[model samples]
Target: MTAAKLPAIGCEHPMAGIARRTHARVPPYAFYEGRKQDWRFSMADEVTLVGQEAEGLAARACRGAGATEPTTRSLVAATMSAALFGPPTLGFPHLVDYLDSFRDGRISTNPQPKLNRPFAAFFVSDADRGIAQLGFDQAFDQFVETVRHFGVAIFTQTNSYTAGELGYFVRRLAAEGIVGLAATNANAMVVAKPGGPAVYSTNPLAFGFPMGDGSPPMIIDQASSATAFVNIVAAASEGRSIPAGWAVDADGNDTEDPNLALKGALLAFGGRKGANVALMVEMMSAGLSGGPWSLDTPDFRSGDVSPGVGMTVIAMMPGVDQAARIARARTQADRLAGLGVFIPGVTGTSKKEQLTIPAGVHRRIAEFAANAPAAGNMSLA
Candidate 1:
């Protein structure tokens, strides 16, 4: 496969502005404060990059790691959004996983994603063992249009690398004034119950809906597990023990040692309730998409083959008087906030124009860029 020329590097996509405006109220630094030790970086060990520069660097890094231009563009946009508005771990840190997969042959550099419409309201995609974002990117316009026409649409994708940030999918729909619920599975690493074998991945689910009052869309994104897998990995890297009930040893005995937990399985967040949520996500994502179950998927971190996970996104148009309904919801949210209730996706405006990256993470990204082959010299085989 021949490499495509890189697109212009900038956060100029339609979602970029909406994400920035909606997430402006979030205090950017708060996400980084408490976990400095686990992340192995202090606030002082940080470098700031303008959004455009960060996106450019991310694109270069992806291209250097053998991704095609289109793949790089899709992944860079998602990465920047995650870094800017979503969880910090899912942003630049997660890009490292994609770069490694590209170099290790776990992900196709130039996958030819194929879309199928078996029904008027349902769309299916084969990612050809590439990143999940590209498949969604390709189907987005059509999916949104379908939702508008039919009042509801469902998109399912199979045979892709693990989704980097599940919230990214729904947030895009929320930007278009649609409600979106998205779910994706990874390799099996979570157990349904104490003393049970692993039967689920972290199995994240995300929901987003437009508020329509200049307030950011309300987004709720979380893993069904007690915590994210990345958090465990970070703890292990920092030689720290995790909280109790987070995981169990390979023998199904509860363990707080991150290393042991890595060898074992993560526990669900609310015991049976969280496990049920994981099961629900698995059914919609892996079951509905014809993708491999978590038990059957390969390890995303170690294998040369793709994990071949699945993602399902359901979009729904609001009811009659959509604008009025959305405004009412916003008013309710404000009233709840006044009662000291924690509202998801509502934060104070952030004034900073640039994003801060931990120096260590920035160095790793820089290395990928510095080592990338020249555009015409790339090999996609």
Candidate 2:
């Protein structure tokens, strides 16, 4: 699970009840990892670079205040995701908000919603979060419980959206029993096995599933890289080697040394198999979406300039046949496993279905989610 503190995430204030249609490009800076020395003072400088309004910053500070006892160290890493992934995603689920809740889920968008032209009327869904993928019975309960906890209900879907379009979907997708999952693809963040610098980050993916029993699987997220790059960078910052297989060094050689690994490229999952998957992710993320992708380009933070990395997401519906497919797959697969073979994606579903969020993350969820606004309103200031 992402163990970092969420960043103080805020957006350009929406003018009127609606915003002037502005198709924005990716921001050119990495996420703001709040600094150690005079951080707010430092941010005053970066905010100018970001060009977000003072009102927005005020909003963020207000949102950050609720943590009865908020900590800078805790919030720094968490907030970093917000700064990095926010713009390209059009503020779907703020990275800080999602990371604050999920260690595994992701963010994504539908290109059709982003198109712009002269004298054209565009309609963003009245709903923003795509939690619709979780269906009604489940999403409603989650919303009720979450609002009871966080004071706000961030939307979800099998697709991407903004705050403006989040609510309607919550009601609509719930009626049909469709599971909603709202997630985003942040900067191409990949952690390879300390050596080979082949492609982009393993990237992060988030999902939400609804169930009649308990909360069901409302959220599932993962990094597409070898290991989460945060861990890799953390190891590097500590001058430690990443657990072998998570990174590599210059010249494509596997090295456990985190510093070298940080300097090198991370390997894709499943070796060639994982590379194929990462490639597909890259295509969907950068290729199909027209967002920045990890090309032969270098990390912009460094002089090494290659293509920047990004993400792409596709949402699917289990529909009325979801159960049938699961049952049939399970029966058929059981028969096969009895004979020595097994299923591929089924394992993923099994783990996803597990109740308690799998790691130390649940406590964090209970803590933050509990105090979040009933509408999930921002509270810090």
Candidate 3:
């Protein structure tokens, strides 16, 4: 989630205005290649099955982050978490970096999830390629083929929800012309000690939208982080840093050096406000949904030492009229434009009801589900 404002530097221009103003400063091309590009997936008879498979993959990734060829479950679990954050049309670099971490292991394994469910995946990120796309190709056979063959490239969730819950929500929402989206966030969850340590990497915000199209309303899911930590790690290993404002040092200073920032903390978008939103996400992702919290826990940012965070899911039903919602949104947006370019969040009331946008998925090991590990559900000796 690239912020359009620069409050850190005392510059708070409108996002679109700023982008337009700066367009001439940069290249004259669309940054994304996947815009308007359809992410066609096999028409699986079991969208629910695919969703469950995605859920399994998310959980397994945290536990089985070390496998050379992780089980379908593991890969899906890891990838889903990451995918929920970026635009649905995420760039290849972002997706690859996120997936690579599963092989390395970054998720935690404590204070397990109390809930878990299948969610329809959808989003769009603002990446170099402009946006990332995800979809379930048509046909159940195609789904099986992809899972068994190319393997799911990425799996993303914005918040915590059981596979069944997510599946039900999306299916119904789509029927009602709304989009449904879900994602999660996690971190070591450390309480900052003033001039000492920084902690907590709350997950992203989960969004569920009722479709607005004859098909389904698109989802505009996201988080506040510029990129996943995996990308930062890759850059560091290759002797590089991030774009800017992605991180800050412990002493309240921003740094392009990923290593230094890693030693410090990931700053929230609007400082304390951003941190507050992060906290909301943390509570929703982990706290409200049942994951980890730094309020009274060890820091996970110190490297999987804490019990990890959970997720936050926002399901929006845009009613049964897709065209009306779009028209209303565009109208309201235009009205707001009468004042000036409306703020980013202002334009998307119904727009936010969408789930599939553009951009990016996959990730590392995490402790448990937003609910609980299914072990307790099984009969014990």
Candidate 4:
């Protein structure tokens, strides 16, 4: 189908508006700043692209893969944020999943997300089987305003694809000087007990607090599972065995085989403790948002149907003594660092403007863009 003939998605001109609305609130990209070193690819197998070039290529690729204009913009922004600041696996690698979903009818190419404010400080959105980022993007302005006015606000979304990186939601709030916590769930792949059936997704959670000293926010983002599902997939692809605690075989016995793990369930990090955390995240995300439970959600990898997961983000405004409190926190953080405590989100400022992506991933994305129908007047901003 021609780009012009595609059904209306959300906003037709989302890039210009998103760029303006988010320019001051989103943290600057720093080329994988604070990202874990283990996720990096070998330099020999990587290709470098300027930030703008990466954005342009990703946007075109999304459109070429049958995503609508608004969906393309939202996907591009979130994917870029992940690629530049969050984990490498959730960055360009994850976008490939969405592109395939769009082509396979697992993600609606022209979703029209709908928003509702059921209460003064409670907002909900239905993503209409589209990417999760579009729903959050649509409600961001109002959500921030609500948080500022009420001191706290809760934003929940349902009927969207699985969230890419939970930290991306809270990080935006931290940039605005607000403390934030976010949680999201996906299809069932994690077992609460070592020998039990899968009862939760990875069920990740993130928290962010602005440092108030012009540095990055103190952010903590992690999955409740021992390892992310992607790691298992990667191991299986490389013909490697996984760690014993990572997952269990189909018979519910712990195993070190990645191939067997794929047929079984992932284990929680700290046994029952991690399972409890996963339960809390499940309630906060899927239960509160009225989305399907992990047990009921479809698998994201092999589905022709949408997983339709949910996300919950809570934004809290600092009190009237916000400046003093923030300063004190920064001072305490400095003292802790001096005492040899490793801070998760503290990193030196990086002036790098280019990203090193896996060459194979880059070529695949470029191929999508090259094969796509012409997108007339689509803004790369």
Q: Count the backbone clashes (under 3 Å) in each candidate.
A: 5, 93, 112, 0
Candidate 3 TM-score to native: 0.41
CA deviation > 4 Å runs, candidate 3: 1-176, 179-183, 189-196, 206-211, 214-218, 226-246, 250-259, 294-309, 320-327, 330-381
TM-score of each: 0.84, 0.40, 0.41, 0.85
Residue 126 miss distance in model 3 (angstroms): 31
Looking at model 2, residue 374 earns an lDDT score of 45
The lDDT per prediction is 0.77, 0.34, 0.34, 0.76
User: What 10-residue stretch in candidate 4 is worst by lDDT?
Assistant: 22-31
Task: Find the number of clashing residue pairs for candidate 2.
Answer: 93
lDDT of 3 by residue, 1-381 (tens): 111211122222222232333222111011122223212111111111133444443434333333222222323432443233223223222223233332323322111212122322211111111001111211122323332333221232222211211222233333444434444444332222223344544334434433234322333444444344434444455578776655665574667887765555544455566666656656555444444453433322122232232333333434345568755754654576588763332333321222321111221112222222343432211
> Can you give the lDDT of residue 136 in candidate 3?
22
Per residue, candidate 4 scores C-alpha lDDT tens digits across 91-198 of 886677778788888899999999999999999999999988899999999999999888999999999988887788887888888899999888777888877898
lDDT of 2 by residue, 137-186 (tens): 23344344443333233432223211111212322332233444332233
Candidate 2 whole-model C-alpha lDDT, 0 to 1: 0.34
Q: What residue runs in model 2 are displaced by over 4 Å at the alpha carbon?
A: 1-176, 179-198, 236-240, 296-311, 321-381
